[model samples]
Target: WLIKNYDYDLIKFLQWTCATPMKLIGKQLTIIDEQDMICLENDYSQCQPSQNSSIIK
Candidate 1:
């Protein structure tokens, strides 16, 4: 619905759905790659979930 109504892309969707909700409760998240490399929000598309990649608090 957001994609159609608000023209949200993947990054915006994640920020609104994940980060925004977390912020509402005072929590946060960090995405890491397979090598434990931190994935910045600008590179959110590269943070695909795998056996090693993770979303941490």
Candidate 2:
């Protein structure tokens, strides 16, 4: 529900992967194309529980 509504940067993320921040790959792949960036945004900032003292949102 939450993960699906965000903006996922598949290209940039994959590029970042296996490098330093993520390290998804090593010295195997030499490039990243459009297919590699299949997914994109995922903003969960709006995921907040209700504070009505009755039920959780």
Q: Model 1 TM-score?
A: 0.20
List, residue by residue over 1-57, the lDDT tens digit for candidate 1. 644666334545354343332212332234322233223566555433344446789
How much is the lDDT of residue 8 in candidate 1? 32
In terms of lDDT, which candidate is strongest? 1
Candidate 2 residues 1-35, lDDT tens each? 32376444543553344232222234234364435
Which candidate number maximizes TM-score?
Answer: 2
Q: Which stretches of candidate 1 lie over 4 Å from their true place?
A: 1-8, 21-57
Worst 10 residues of 2 by lDDT: 18-27
Candidate 2: lDDT over CA atoms?
0.38
